[model samples]
Target: MTRPSNDSLNAAWDLIDHSQLILVVMHTNPDGDALGSGIALTLGLRQQGKEAHLVCPQPTPLIYEFLNPGDIVEPEAPAGVPDLAVVVDCDRADRVGALQGLVNQARRVLVVDHHPPTSDFGDVRLSHDGYAATAEVVHYLLAHRSVPVTGRMAEALMTGLITDTGGFRFSNTRPETLEMAASLARAGASVADISRRVYDSRTLAGLKLLARALASLQSSPAGTVAWARLSADDFAETGAAPEDTEGFVNVVHSLRGADVAALLREEQPGVVRISLRSRGAAVVSQAAEALGGGGHALAAACVLEASLDDAEERLLQELRKWTAF
Candidate 1:
């Protein structure tokens, strides 16, 4: 909960300006927020006369492609790594997958994130839980340095801010959040268009994934937690890509009497991915970090080295102990 000092911001600005090449990385299986923030920062860094590129461990989310500049992310680092590496929207280096070495190889690593961190991975970290999305933090960084916004930057940043904030419906939506969104809109970001692309468009495979998840929904006796699971075989059955289940967990959370909702997915043979959402500040990141994962307080996630069934059992055990308080 420490406020970032002026010295840290100034140091980040200096590093960003002096670096010849800057490489930006986001977490694996990126969502709208991750893509939006990374692309906006890419634009911001380029505008400052620095060469910037985006690298992710996996392919860009289909929903995000429309908002971002076409094919902005390079799945592999081209040629050599950059002089400076920056991670956006993610807290830990492990989440960057193969890109972790790129971060370690960099002379300077600047992390701009909003997620609650279990480790101090950044040489200069500007983290604020008050912000709804990482794009909001990037917006502040641009404003602090008096950087002008282009329509591309505005569109990207606005997509992140609106989607992560649930169209400003979540409780984290504050006056400053709205102010940031208004600024992006004034700079030529279209709210209606962003909504249409992000929410209105969905593939048949995605709907099948949703149906499978909903069929697996189970609730606790106290109605405190509602959970669903999707195994690897289910993905094969539905022909659903990982990105198809982007916000499927939120559907379980929307149920009546549910204070918390969780989704467990089997990414591969042995990797199980879990997403947790709480109606209040239950601090799921602590639990996630304990299981070698990390995220925000209200919405945290972890990947367990176990089957989806085993991971669910372990996660529910932790939740039972936490809710006991």
Candidate 2:
């Protein structure tokens, strides 16, 4: 909400304006907001006659393929080292995976994010948790500069807004959020099309994985903390990847009397990835931060180096400490 400061925010714009070559990146395993904002920014920059490329640690997830061009995002940076790099929807450079080296090599870096702060890395950090998603920040900046919101940019930014706000159903959806959405809709972003593609287009493998995740659901004695687990075997058997597990934790959060929900997936024998979501006064990010992850107050994530059993107990303890319920 404090913005990257007025001066810092302007400096970010100045930096982008002056730079000729730019690289845009998001966190590893990016969600809709990260991907959407990244695409919109890259396209906007290119429209202004600057050279911009988007480099992600992983390939685009299947569900989001519709919003991306075939060659828009790549796993590797271009041969030429960019003069400026803009980190979108992410606060830490390390979260961009092996590409952090390339980011460091850039003459300057600007971080545009909507998460609570974790570490400071970029020269200009536009960290605003007040906005519902990073895409909103991009849209506002574009508007401030009087940049035309093309249909492509509108659709991409709309994807960011709708997905991160859980289709405008989450607590983060402010009046401004709805206004931005309405504006994008006016600019030719189709709400019905985006909803169907993002929320209702899961693959058959993903559906099987969701079923397994539901079957593994468990809860605390008071049912205030609900959780589910998935082994590597579950993914293999279901032919689903980590991306398929997206939003599964939210399903656990829907449990009656649950203030906090978690989904723990064993990526391998000893490592487990966890997602946490909360309702009411629970600040799940505090627990996630303690677990070496970071996100918003209502939603967060972390990874565990311990066995699945130990990881579950550790996450439960942290969630219990943070949740009033």
Which number leads on TM-score? Answer: 2
Best by lDDT: 2
Lowest-sum lDDT 10-residue window in model 1: 1-10
Q: Give TM-scores for every candidate, taking all chains together and pairing residue i with residue i.
A: 0.92, 0.95
Q: How displaced is residue 196 in candidate 2, in Å?
A: 0.9
Let me know the TM-score candidate 2 reaches against the reference structure. Answer: 0.95
Collision pairs in model 2: none
lDDT of model number 1: 0.83
Deviation from native of the Cα of residue 61 in model 1, angstroms: 1.1
lDDT of 2 at 297: 86
Each candidate: RMSD: 2.2, 1.7
- Residue pairs clashing in model 1 are none
**Which tens-of-lDDT digit does each residue in 49-123 have in candidate 1?**
988888875766778878644557877776675889989887777878788888898889999988766679888
In order, what lDDT does every prediction score?
Answer: 0.83, 0.87
